[model samples]
Target: IQQKEHPKFKRKGDDLFVEHTLSITEALCGFQFILTHLDNRQLLVKSQPGEVVKPDSFKAINDEGMPMYQRPIMRGKLYIHFTVDFPDSLSLDQSKALEAVLPPKMTAQISEMELD
Candidate 1:
């Protein structure tokens, strides 16, 4: 049966895509949340400690999306497209705190620096 829309997610073929926004803190420190699926299932979506989810990146939950058309046993993947919501500016205290908690910035090789 065709429906007008699924409020929480959008479907592409058999896969489902969720557009989610995370605070800079959540992106860096990792987060956990529950998602209500189209079929009335609660899904746990999370990130491991120290796992940074970059902006515009995606993580997929296998077999958690839509079922294939005419294929009941098989299911598509749920893709969470993350957008990191960074502040326009950070206070000195916030900056210092982040520096202490986060890893050092990655240094580029001499060859790669030329591309910057």
Candidate 2:
């Protein structure tokens, strides 16, 4: 039987992939959300403390994908692809705060000829 396309999930064999968008703050800090599975199950998805999810990163939930053929109890993996949504612009105070908390910026020296 062919699988129907889901609004939030893409299936390849038994594996499922879903894209989740997170705010910039959520990516750097922590985030939690409920994911509705194909079986209509509500899964609580969250990031660990101090665990930063970079853009285009992926996380997986074991045995949470489609049920394996001939094995209804067994399932494949569910992958969550994370996308970070950054603000178009940051306020001066916000920028300063980020700079203070993040790693120090690297300085580079350029000659005047390089500017030309």
Best by lDDT: 2
lDDT by residue for model 2 (10-63), tens: 988889999999999899999999998887999999999999999999999999
Instruction: List TM-score per model, in order.
Output: 0.80, 0.91
Indicate the worst ten consecutive residues by lDDT in candidate 1.
1-10
Q: What tens-digit string does per-residue lDDT give for candidate 1 at 18-85?
A: 98999987997889988888877888899987798999999999998788989979999999999999
State the C-alpha lDDT per candidate: 0.89, 0.94
RMSD per candidate (Å) reads 4.5, 1.6
Maximum-TM-score candidate: 2
